[model samples]
Target chain A: MIAILSGGVGAARFALGMRQIIDPTEISIISNVGDDEVLHGLHISPDIDTVTYTLGNAINPDTGWGLKNETWHAMDALTDYGGITWFRLGDRDLATHLFRTQLLSEGKTLTQVTDRIRKRWKVQPRILPVTDDELRTVLYSVIDGRAQQLTFQEYFVRYAHKPAVSRVIYEHSAEARMTPSVIQALENAEAIVIAPSNPILSIGPILAVPGVSEILSRRRERVVAISPIVAGQAVKGPAAKLMAELGLRQSAYGVAEYYKDIISAIVIDDTDAGLADQIRLLGIKTFPTNTLMTSPETSKNLASAALSMISGEPV
Target chain B: MIAILSGGVGAARFALGMRQIIDPTEISIISNVGDDEVLHGLHISPDIDTVTYTLGNAINPDTGWGLKNETWHAMDALTDYGGITWFRLGDRDLATHLFRTQLLSEGKTLTQVTDRIRKRWKVQPRILPVTDDELRTVLYSVIDGRAQQLTFQEYFVRYAHKPAVSRVIYEHSAEARMTPSVIQALENAEAIVIAPSNPILSIGPILAVPGVSEILSRRRERVVAISPIVAGQAVKGPAAKLMAELGLRQSAYGVAEYYKDIISAIVIDDTDAGLADQIRLLGIKTFPTNTLMTSPETSKNLASAALSMISGEPV
Candidate 1:
């Protein structure tokens, strides 16, 4: 079994490529829930939904999230009431939130609800949230000389990730324990892949959960990380910008430094070959390759290379 | 000021007629909350929406409820997850539930949410729920030779009102208190109307709230009811069937008898003129008129006639 630590769009795209080289049934995706939010009384797990929609082949290609051919009637109608429409929940995508929220209210765990949803979408991989307990990624930033604390979405979406964040904290993570499913996935996997997602915003929440980082650190040899940074820039989203704001070098070397303690190998884009030796100096094996993943074939090749580093097998 | 005790479709239609004679701002509608339900984590007030839609001219003319050009995309998508779609929520209608649920979760009362919703619909009348507390109408019925207890929506919508009801009870009416707005509307209105809605299922719930029936009975001379029945049957719905099952005479006379204690006068259809003397014998003045309300003009004339009984003015 192969386990992937995932975030949202970037991770979903990486999972799409992972599917090409492995049987989906053999994959287990332990997803981050720090970005999950309650808007309009609906529990929305953005990362989990992104993974589900992308794996189900229902994702909007333009947005890299939400459903293709989705309608905004519900959101549009909400505008008449002067309701909060900044979150952008589409009509078709609302069914998932409704189903999840209703089931959760009926005393079902997030894990059980996610299982039902993925099966309904005909998605083969097992997708488990890192923890069922509340864990919000809160950002501390000073915008216009006034210090403010914002939810991850507020910093990323509402503020368009423009504010310089001083620190990011996972709220309630101190009391959060890994769900049994997630723990079992981490323990039973033959190999683990830290998908190319935002380090602080996505994977940071997963590592914050009690015992998660310890387990990864102990089994470092079986773990490999694909850097989100390619050629000194993030392929999408604010990974590079957030890293820079947080005082980390915004390059492949920086991604390697972030996961160096929990991973034995790191995959960097070929354009950043100059940084490979510097990353290796941190006691992490750096494999420089074409990690841009602009298409299905490129994504697959990237996944194969990352797997090969740990497996020592020719694909 | 004029106040109307209301239910769903029939009451909404009557309200439309009332709007034609009085300035909408001068009208106050005290609506029943017995039929309110929580479905898919959404707080749905079917009667409130019906009144708002009907008065705003956005109601589906064919069904007498829901939006005029509603789409069912959200409900359809729910089917993919084997989620409950029995209640038939439309995409456009979902915004109301979402808005209400969010506000209520934020500690706002149902009365406050309803006020906001009505204003958003451009509805001018003051629509207030009979009570902000939980008050569910539960029906005791014998269906397929088995006795069962059913919610108002379950009996009326899910089962299509086919079960023979032995009795009906307001589940939480004992603990329910009338909202201040409802009490004020009843006390300050020049005339109070009991709309042409099902007495046992619709109006019954409103009266069940504490102090509601007492206020109407104290001011009996100012309160008049428009009988939903014409001749020997209800204008719409299973009002006659339910009344017969509950052992009441299935006629306009039965309606007067049911409300005789609180109502001083009643307006029945011209077809039921023969029952007038019998209803009047019970000490309730009966006015026979063309109460079919087949069109806007007819509805307006019926409202004018009902208003004239107490006001003694040519409306």
Candidate 2:
């Protein structure tokens, strides 16, 4: 079985491509929980939901998040009731949150709740949260001349990621250990693929989980990473902005360096070919190709390329 | 303030009539909370919502509950996800639950959360829950020749009120005292009205709150009840059937007897006129008229008659 480390939209799209190369049932996704939050008293795991919706063919193509054909009656009603509604929860999407919240309140772990959602969606990919315990990314940012700390949702959704983030702290990650299932998936995987996601916000928290770094370190030679950065920019989201703000390089070389200790190979975009030698200097094998996953066919090609890099087809 | 004891649809309809006679701002409704239940991990107070939505003119006139122009996207989606969708929660109605749940989770009392919902609806009536504490009405029923207990929502919504109920339990009602506002409204009311709600299921729970019965007893002379049953038939809901199952007389005289000590007068329907003398024998004055609240005019007339029966003008 192949294992993947994931964030939200970018990772979900990459997973879609990967599933095309291998059977969806053969893939296990370890999703970031730092962006998980409680909104309107409902537990929302954005990253896990993204992966589920994408795999289930229910995701809204325009937003790359939430469900398609979603209605906003609930949010509109909540808005009229003077409820805080900066985080837009579609009516169709709310069912997932409500069910998740119900299961969590009934003392089920996030992993169990996620499994229920995945099965309901008829998604074959095994999506597991990196940590079952609460682990949130808190962003310290300056918005409208006011310096404040905001939850990942508040920073990402409420402000539309407009504020200049000074720092990001992953709460509870240090104390949160990998779930047994996730640990087993990592241990049994023939190859590991780190999806092209926001490094600091998405993959950072997943790596920060206690013992996750050590596990990846042991399986370093079998791991590969696809750069979220293409040239000097992110194909989607605020990955480049957040990486630059957090005092990290916002290029393919930077991505390779970040995953250097955990990955033996890195897939850089065709535009970042000049950075191949630099990425190789980090003691990582560089594969320069059209990494921009815009269409299903192109994404499948990219997935195949990444898969072939693994020894013995990593079946 | 004119205080009214309420249940759900029937009581809301009666209150709709009362508001036509008196300014809605002058009315205080002490709604029963025994029907309250947590569905999908969201707190749902059906009685309180009915009153709030009806008074706010946001209620779907056809359903007698939920908001006008509401959508069922969330419930539909929840159904697709295999979550329980028996208690149909409309999309617009979900906002109330979400907001209430959030406030309650934030350590706010149900009263405070209810006030927020009321104000957001721009409703002028003082809608107060009988008690802020948990008071759920559980039904012990024999469905399909099997004996089992269920929540009020399950018995009502899930079972469609079809089960033969052996008993009705008001959980935690004995420990629940009236909220301060409800107590004050009761103490200062010109007239206390018992809306034409189900006696065994609706008004029964309100009367079960620890100190509420005593307060009504102290003001017995000014207490007036509008019989939900007219000519041994309920205008709405399972009042008649439940009363018969629970061993109470399913007639207006039964209603007068039900409130004998706390209510000095009762407004029965013209159809129940033949039972007036029997009701009078129960030490209660009877006001027989066209008490079927088929129209706003009839309901207002009924309200006016009940207001006039308060010993003094008590307007």
Candidate 3:
């Protein structure tokens, strides 16, 4: 079994690429859950839905999120009622939340709901939430010159992640235990691949789970990470800005340092060749290649490289 | 002031005609609530939405319900999750339910939500539900040689109102009180009109509220009703089938008898002009004209005749 740690768009895209190189049936994706929130009384898990939609070939290629040919009729009507429309819920996407909310209210766990959704999408990989319990990412941002804590959506959607964030913390991560399937997937994996997602915002919360980081630390030799921040900038989203604001290195070297304790090798872009020595000095192997996944071939090649790196194949 | 005791489609269409003769702002429609039901955890008041959408010019003319140019993406997706898709919910229409559900959860009454929704639609008619409390229409039907009780939607939508209904009852009608607006609108009205909706299915529930029938009975001289039946046939819906099943008068004369106690006059169609003298024998005046609202002119003419009948104008 091949286990993958994933977030939203980047993670989903990477998994799509990885599918090109391996049997999707052999993959178990442990998706981030810190971005989950209840909107309009409907339970929404952004990461899980993104991965599920992406793998099922239902994702909107334009936005890299939501469903293809989706309509925003509900949202357009919502604006007339003075409802918050920042998060951008599409017409078709509302079904996932409605089904999930109904099932969860009927005493089904989030895990069961996720399974039902994936089954409907016919997604091949086993998509497991990091935890079924409540765990959220809260950011302390300076708004109107006063530091106030905001939920992940508020920071990311409402404020457009423009406000200066003083700190980022995970809520309930300390007490939340990883799901049994996730633990088993980790234990039985031939290799664990960390997807090229936002290291701090996306991947950080997964590591904060009580036993997740420890498990990866123990199996460090088989853990490989693809750096999202390449050439000091993220290919998409706010990784570089967030890292710079959080007072961390904004280069591939910074990404390697973030996962150094729990990873055997770090894949940097060809542009980040100058940072190889620095990452190597931190006691982690570096794989330099054309990591910019502009096409399916690149992403699949990246997946092949991860596999080769795990099997001790020559670079 | 003109007060209309209303239900769905027929009532909304009647109100549209009435608007052609009078200022919409001067009209107050007290709608039936016995058909209201919760589906997918969303509070849906079909009658209220119909009247609201109709007056706002946003209604689908072909279907006689829902918004114009609406998308069914949410509902189509819902079918994949094994949800009940028989009660079609369009994408834009889901916003109304979502807003209503959220506002109701936040302690806003159904009246408040209705006002908010109408205001957004820019509807001028003061559409008020008969009561804010829980009230539903339940039908007893014989299916597969067994007597079964079903909600109004099940009888109307799921079964296409096909099952032989033995009886119809209203839930919580005795305990439910009319909203303050409805009571005040009724007490101060110059004329009260029972729209040409399904009398047993629509107008029956409105009058079923504990004090509503008594209030109108006391003001019997000022009240007028339009017959849904004309020449032993209903203009639309299951009214004809239901009236026949319930063993009520299946003609305009029968309609006159149904409202004989509280209404001063009943408007029948030109086709049913032969039954006027027989209706007058029941101590009610009969206004026979072209009541087939096939065009805006016919609906407007019917509305004008109803107004003239109230004022002793030449019929």
iRMSD (Å) of candidate 3?
A: 1.3
Candidate 3 clashing pairs, residues 3+ apart or interchain: none
**Which 10 successive residues of model 2 chain A have the least lDDT summed?**
A306-315
TM-score to true structure, per model: 0.96, 0.95, 0.85
For all candidates in order, the CA lDDT equals 0.91, 0.89, 0.87
Clashing pairs in 1: none
> Candidate 1 chain A vs. true chain A: TM-score?
0.97
User: Per-model TM-score of chain A alone?
Assistant: 0.97, 0.97, 0.97
Give a tens-digit lDDT track for model 2, residues A142-229: 7778889999888888888888888988988778989998999888899889999988889999998988889889988778999999
List the candidate numbers ranked by lDDT, top first.
Answer: 1, 2, 3
- DockQ agreement of candidate 1 with the native complex: 0.73
At residue A224, give the lDDT of candidate 1.
Answer: 94
In order, the B-chain TM-scores come to 0.97, 0.97, 0.97
The backbone clash count of each candidate, in order, is: 0, 0, 0
lDDT by residue for model 1 over A56-125, one digit each (tens)? 9999999988999999999999989888787888998999999999899999999999999999889999
